[model samples]
Target: MPRALVIEDDHKIAELIKIHLKDLHYEIDHTLDGLEGYEMAKKTNYCLIILDLMLPSMDGMEVCRKIRANDIASPIIMVTAKSEEIDRVLGLETGADDYIVKPFGVREFQARVKAVLRRSLGKFENQSSTNNQIIEADGLSIDLDKRSVQKEGIRIELTPKEFDLLSLLAASPGKSFNRQSLLNLVWGYDFEGYEHTVNSHINRVRAKIENDMNKPSYILTSWGYGYRFNENI
Candidate 1:
């Protein structure tokens, strides 16, 4: 069974998440205090972390920053009651692999967790078998073997999901992929309305690898179709 960490302060919410996660066959550890949760997370190798935005001892953002700073590569799903789009985007930009709003149904919650884990598992299985081919376009370089990306000789730090999205698109240059296809291929989720997640990741990736966000050199919008890599690059 894969280990999971749930850092939620609300007993009711935490218990609800615990029950569903247990049903999924995960061995979970829970904590009400953010600082305590961080300590527990550091002590264990967890496959996934369900983190709440509000907690005692430390806030969710700080916990996320600390965990990433510690180099823990576990996927994080940030739960928040704030429904603002900015809040959700901030969580994603904060190194979290996914996010869920409070008041979500058990099915949606479980599905999100499963999707994240499935994506991680696929990446792990492909780490060795992924043809060790290097992709170079303009000033950008992607080392599939090292799972590293660089632009203009400077290494760029990308979240695992961002890198996966970039690799998938780059692997098939000039192929226009709709958001649903990208989500299914990169996130292991086929749900509707989450296409914006792909858009956000694409924008972020372009920001990192492209010199001008307004006029991207590599990633190009397919207009009616979705997105595709610049074939001319």
Candidate 2:
């Protein structure tokens, strides 16, 4: 059975999540402290991580950042009581795969979990289909199977999301993708107003891969449409 971790301070909430996850056939580890949860996550490979935003020892945002920094690419579902747009946006920018606000119904929470898991599965499937495929343009090289990127013979480390975004664009050079399309293709969910998520990720990708952010050669703004890879390269 796949494993799941729940890092929630509220005993009742944690138990509720645990019960539902058990029903879903996931072997579960429950922790109320963020530091301990982080340690557990580092040691164990979990299929899903449900983390509360406000945690003792470490907040969820910090935990998410640290996990991504360490290259732990497990899908994470952030649980927050705050409903503000900034909080949700920050959570996503921090590397969370999804977030669910408190006071959410069980159905909504379950749907989010299913959606994240489905997306993870879809990533694996897509990778298999493109196995051994490599796209080269200018100095940039993307190995789809290895999920690695290189520029001018030097390795460039990218977050999982960053790699996905870059690979998607590179796979179809000159094909413009609107923010909504990118969001649906990359995030696996339609987050209506979270289009800024796409912008922030694009900026980060450019910062890493482009020689000049001011005049990027790889990814170009489509002018009133969205963004696309430079076919000229």
Candidate 3:
């Protein structure tokens, strides 16, 4: 069974989420304190993590950043009462794969969890189609089998999402992929209104790989189309 961690301070909310996750056949762990939750997350492995933005001892954003800084790639779903667009974008930038506003329905929550897991599986499926070889372009080397990247002979560390997004673009050099298409392929959902998520991932990937974000060599803007990898590279 898949495992999940729910770090929600509200007793009722946490239990509700736990019950629903259990219904989906997930082994769930719950924590009410942010510090404790962070400790538990660091100590254990989970397929997914559902975290509330507001909590005691620490904030959800910091927790997400800490996990990512530790190189943990498990998908995170951030829950927040604030429905501001800035909050959503900030959560994603901090490394949460998805976010849920407060008062969400059970079905919506379930769908989000399933969608994230599906995206993870889709990544595996995409990798399986490749021959497990390294792709080289303009001094950049990406080992598909190892999931490692090196720029100009220097190893570059990237988040799992960053690497996946770059891999998709680089694998099909010169092919333009619109934001929606990239979101569907990379995020495993076409629910709409999440193209900015794709843009954020692309920008982060470029920061890691490009000598100049202003003049990226690997990934290129397709103007009105969307984004494409540099075929010339």
Candidate 4:
């Protein structure tokens, strides 16, 4: 069973999540304080973390930053009452894999959790495989086995999700994948309704791969259709 750590101060919300996750056969551990949550995350090998932005001892953003700084790569899903776009972006920038606002449906919440866990486990499997997958396009080279990307002979540091997004687009250059499609492909089948996650990750990827994110060359937008990779580049 996959282990999950939930850092939520709300008793009702935390209990709801624990019950649902237990139904899905996940080993659940939870805390009502951010500091304790962060400590537990560092000491354990959890498959995923459900973290709330508001906490008694420490804020979730600080916990997230500390976890990333410590090289903890487990997937983190931020649960926040704050629905502001900037708040969501900040969570992602702080190394959160995904985020969901409050007043969310239970089904959607469960789906997001499953999706994150699946993606995390899938990455582990991919890393174990001996796949000769080095995608080169427009002065960018991505090595799947090594899990690294180089642009114009210079290595770029990318988050795990950023790397996945780039690889998906690079693998099918010129193919436009809608936000939902990309989410399902890169995130997992269980991911639902948060297309913004795709948009944010794409922007981050472009920042690393393109000289200017505003005028991206490798990953082009298909307007209403979605986003496509520049195969000719």
Highest lDDT: give the candidate number: 2
Instruction: Report the candidate with higher TM-score, 1 versus 4.
Output: 1
Write the residue-wise lDDT of candidate 4 on 58-142 in tens digits.
9999998888777677789998775565666678767788888887777988888877655643443333353547878878898
lDDT of 1 by residue, 203-230 (tens): 8788778888999989999998799988
Candidate 1: residue 182 Cα off by (Å): 1.4
- The 10 consecutive residues of candidate 1 with the worst lDDT sum are 120-129
TM-score of each: 0.65, 0.78, 0.76, 0.63
User: lDDT of all the models against the reference?
Assistant: 0.81, 0.85, 0.82, 0.80
Q: How many Å off is the CA of 208 in candidate 1?
A: 1.3
Model 1: per-residue Cα lDDT at residue 16: 92
- Give the total clashing residue pairs for model 4: 0
lDDT of 2 at 113: 89
**Candidate 2's residue-wise lDDT over 32-141, tens digit each?**
99999999989998889999888999998899888876767788999887656687888887788888888777788888888887665445345457644888999999
Model 3: per-residue Cα lDDT over 36-56, one tens digit each: 888888888788999988889
**Model 2 — TM-score against the truth?**
0.78
Candidate 2: 10-residue stretch with minimal lDDT: 119-128
Give per-residue lDDT, candidate 1, residue 8. 97
lDDT for 40 in candidate 2 is 90
